[model samples]
Target: MKATRQLHDLGQSLWLDNITRSLLDDGTLARYIAEDSITGLTSNPSIFDAAIGGGDAYDAGIHAKTLAGLSGEALFTELALEDLRRAADLFRPVFDATGQVDGWVSMEVSPLLAADSAGSIAAARHIHHQGRRDNLFVKIPGTPEGVPAIEEAIFLGIPINVTLLFSCAQYQAVAEAYLRGIERRLAAGLDPRVGSVASLFISRWDVAANPQLPDALRNQLGIAVGQQTYRAYRELLASKRWHKLAAAGARPQRLLWASTGVKDPSAPDTLYVSALAAPDTIDTIPEKTLHAFADHGQLHGVLADDGGDADAVLAQIAAAGVDLDALALKLQRDGAAAFVKSWQQLLQRIADKASALEKESQLP
Candidate 1:
């Protein structure tokens, strides 16, 4: 059996952290679904920027949308919804087989609204309503502003992929937001089992903190953080609060490992994928890493529910002068900024493509 199938049987999901028109048109996504057990997908402005800016796949679509008077965010949203709808349809069978617990596709809200709770909420509602796919997860950052938006969106029955979470503490914040949202749903006599996932970035910790630590500690911080958060996740799953919510038909907000692509080439290509393998969580991996793992990844063993030696590793790093709390905040802020940069670049790519397509049409 493929290693990807092994991970699935272990009860963890493998979601592709990518989307593009070519991926959908060329049957690559479908092939992954069949051969590699890619049950779902996730997308952000950076991925879209790479897809649109990197090729002419979207030129005709942008031109047509431009003709329809859509520009800027509107044009981008329409394009994204098209791709997400296709991806969601492809995963619909998995959605049915898993009874709606899996088989999902995620599209992020405007990064411009990362700090605007009201704006984020409005954009989420608009995006979800327009996408019209029940399996689509509208991603919102878990920033202070975004936490409330997650709750509000969930209360209204929107499936949310809470992004940009860094530490166990940050995960706790959004986990509570999810809980509060479900509690409100129960209060309103609505089903509280709306799907949600709190994404904790993995490889970025090594990318950000490795330079400040000893060479022996290289490429280990991220996995340590994963262990820390996994402990929190197991604890939450076993908590009385979760049990009460479960009784009311509320599902647990799944823990997702984002940024699983290895930043250190010296590290194993499947570094994060193997080290962080745990059941009941999700790992949304980049295409490169996904294929690498399918070919050669091994699940050494599942993470310890009590967090194993994560505390010792973290303490050693802390003693070496790493301020994890402060670093977590910085990573979250940097991530939000990076998305904003990508969002602007994607919009410009759309505008440029639309213009070029129109000029080509004007050529007699």
Candidate 2:
């Protein structure tokens, strides 16, 4: 059996952290689902930016939308939704087969609104309503500003994928926000089972710390951070507050490992995927990493529920002069900014393409 199937059978969900018109049209995504045990997918501005900007696959749609007088962010979102809605439908079977626990596709709100909670909330609602798929999740960053937006969106029954988190504390905070949202739903006599996932970034931790840590500590920070966060996840699920919410028909807001692609060429390609497997959690992996895992990844063991060795690893990093808390905040901010930059570039690319296509169409 493929290692991907092993990991899935062991209880962790494998989500393809990418989507594009080509991948969907070419049967790559479907094959991953059918053979590699991939149960879900995730998309961000960066992914869509690369997808649309990297190829001509979306040119026809871009031309149509442009001819229809849509451009900029509005135009970009319509194109993105076209891809996501199709991906969502492809995964609907897993969603139904698993009774809503698996097969989710995530679409993030604009990164430009990262600091604007109200704007983020409104965009999330609009996207959720526009997609009109229960398997779709509106991804919100887990930054301080975004936490409130996450809560509000979840309270409104929008399935949320809390993105850009970097620390155990960050994960806990987002999980708490999700629980509060469910509690509110129960209070308002709404169903409490609105789905959510807190996406804690993994490989970026090591990427950020690689220059600062010694050779011995290289490529270890990401796994350590995931370990620590996994401990918090297990604790939260076992807590009384979560139990109350779970009994009230709510599903646990799962932990999702984001940014799982190995950045260091010297590191094992499957380092993050093999080491971070845990029950009831989701790992959204980039395409390269996903293919690498399917090729050579091994599912040796599950992560210790108590976060074995994570504290020691983190302490060593601190002793080596890394302040994790400060770095976590910086990563979250930088991640939001990076997405915004990618989003702007994507919009510009779409505008350029739309203009060129419009000129061609008028040449008739």
Clash count list over all predictions:
0, 0
Per-residue CA lDDT of candidate 1, range 222-289, in tens?
99999999999999999999999998888899999999999888889999999988999999999999
What TM-score would each prediction reach against the true structure?
0.99, 0.99
Model 1 stretches astray by more than 4 angstroms: none
> Residue-wise lDDT of candidate 2 within 278-323, one digit each (tens)?
8899999888898899999988689998999999999999999999
- Predicted structure 2: clash tally: 0
lDDT for residue 26 in candidate 1, whole number 0-100: 100
lDDT of each: 0.94, 0.91
Measured by lDDT, the strongest candidate is 1
